[model samples]
Target: MFSSKIVTFNKINFLNKLSDGFKITNKSHREYFNLGHPLESPPTLRGSMVVEFKMSFILDNEEFFEYGSPVDIGGLSAGYIGLENYKASDLKVNFFDFDKIISEISAVRFYERQKFLEHEITESVYGILKSNFNNDLADFIRFDENPHSRLFEFCLAGGYKINEDHVQKIHIPNTYKNSLLMKRISDRFKGRVLTFNPKYGFESRNVG
Candidate 1:
């Protein structure tokens, strides 16, 4: 049901092409993913925005077949609705998978060490992996939150590459790293929640 192809992972070259605001078609086992416009129908993309379909094969499961690429890393799944019925974080007990919710909160975004060459552009699946928690419910909407930093970090680490945590500490761009600092100043204010929104050309405006 998806068009699959093998492509090289070039950090700057790729992101330069992927300007911003793209849709992903995979959730679990994100091995085969499609990037394209939100309005396009699947299977047959007429003027498909699908940038490319890539498979980062593993050489006998030991190393990535592609020089600096790694196997597909998974992302957080949007939980089903009717969550009020879930009582607690119990794997067998909670149908909502509450225990997994805790893991989602603490999940660390790391990558395979062997796939990268100590210092090379990697991938932004880290942010994808980090969507378990975010500034907004992007999983439900399937939107990328830290595109600016994702782009910046992609330059430093290259797409998804980073210095192994053991080798060098990660230096996140100020946009994402200090994003929470504003909340410190924000908690002081209590305002009405936005309840009305109107769709505009590409972008939306809060008409409430």
Candidate 2:
């Protein structure tokens, strides 16, 4: 699904853009402003008037994926409505998967790793040892913090299943350390772990 949080500002210039107002210049101050008050007449006018508008859009997966560039939406060039004066916060959009995309990715990674190992250990005598290792790894894979509980349950329902019988433990060192196991975990969970910051807006298309 696709979602958007939009804020608009209504300013005097907006009326001018609509060709409903005349520009009145303050010659002494070298400044110009719109004279017409479309909503309220001059006698009833107060100081300057500003309005803020905020709207959210939620679209289905197909629509969301089809969103064109922001520039095509008129973006900042769209006449102010009052949105500029108000500070809009907490704008977020996340794509959730009903199917266990993370688990699928993890399973693929495990299969690839196992295939690589099988190619290296060519000796038939090590078949039993390899089988034991695979079983242990699969057990470890199933041992999440709470196996019964799903991550981001409220936002996205359905649970992912751990399929591997033998997976490696993630281990990292302080010195230029890179653990393949840790990388797998990060790749699987990165989408859920990262969040949009109010101070710095962010956007994500997928949960895995």
Candidate 3:
């Protein structure tokens, strides 16, 4: 089974919020990341600029399988609202191969969401994603589901560079290509490829 996580950033107020509300059962952990010196190790550094909320979700194998089913969210059953405070800004997302660090941070949110949704797990998750990411780029979004794993996929445009402020412009590599397994959006704007870890959820601003 797969897990999910959502991270939000109120760029205006500079507030960060992370939630693991998309799990199979309801066992998740949410906390704030301390970017202070010593603690600024690997994981912390990767997530440094974040200030305020840090959350997580975790689920066991049995519970995960039971609630990881997929549901369609096209019409009424869909609980998505359009993006809030829509702004012309840049966003980036990154997909990682299963590793210990990724698994641990992601597991917290994955399990938490499962527990939150005693039922209606799939539909609820779909709604949340649609509401949060439904922009001019919605068509670029994708998902992966398997008995043992699951993943959320998407692409970003608009000159956003990795490890830089959203306002800065970056050039995309000319080698970028589109495929069934992966899609590329290359134009005058900077394009980035992103995939979310179904288990760990998402990170605000750090989507690259």
Candidate 4:
């Protein structure tokens, strides 16, 4: 279940708010980030951390939607455990405008350009998508590595490394455009993994 009220926030306060972690309940489609559950749970999320927010560029662009599908441009997601799996170059945390980076990395090809936009998940679900997308394991984890289906074969007894080619194809952020913001994010989250932002605290969608 989700609250019908739309949440809002600005980049500045949002950055500050994330320093304190939070939890979201009833998240759908991000079972990977929840710490203690057996992977059998469905795509729906019981709860998840809001480590990263993928702001929807399209939300403000009605023109873009006129010609293209009105996709739920972006949403929040977790980046803790999954981030560690990425190489420094792949992570590219300090080299991008968060919005631009996610857009490019999750280009149209990965998503069904038209009908896909109709289905949207909560911030927690988006967080799961973010984690997998950033870590370059979206496909592998979703299709090939069904840890639940093959618990012994994959989860307990198997191991694999990230495919360099796959990671190479993902987008790299442009640090020049937003270095200061990137620095703040990187510094605040440095050496910290598996943490998330509070679902409701500082302010969501606050305006002065």
Clashes of each: 9, 14, 30, 12
TM-score of each: 0.16, 0.13, 0.17, 0.20
Cα lDDT tens digits for candidate 2, 88-150: 111111233312222232234454434322221212312322343343322322332222111
Candidate whose lDDT is highest: 4
Candidate 3 Cα outliers beyond 4 Å, as residue runs: 1-112, 115-121, 135-142, 145-208
Model 1 lDDT per residue over 39-153, tens place = 1111221211112221121111112111111111111113322222322121121212322432332343344221111112233433433443332322322233322111110
lDDT of each: 0.22, 0.22, 0.25, 0.26
Predicted candidate 3 versus true structure: per-residue lDDT over 109-149, tens digit per residue: 56545532222224444444445445333322223222111
Which ranges of candidate 4 are over 4 A from the true structure? 1-92, 95-98, 105-208
TM-score of candidate 2 to 2 decimals: 0.13
Top TM-score model: 4
Candidate 4: 10-residue stretch with minimal lDDT = 149-158
Which candidate model has the greater lDDT, 1 or 4? 4
The residue-level lDDT of candidate 1 at 121 comes to: 21
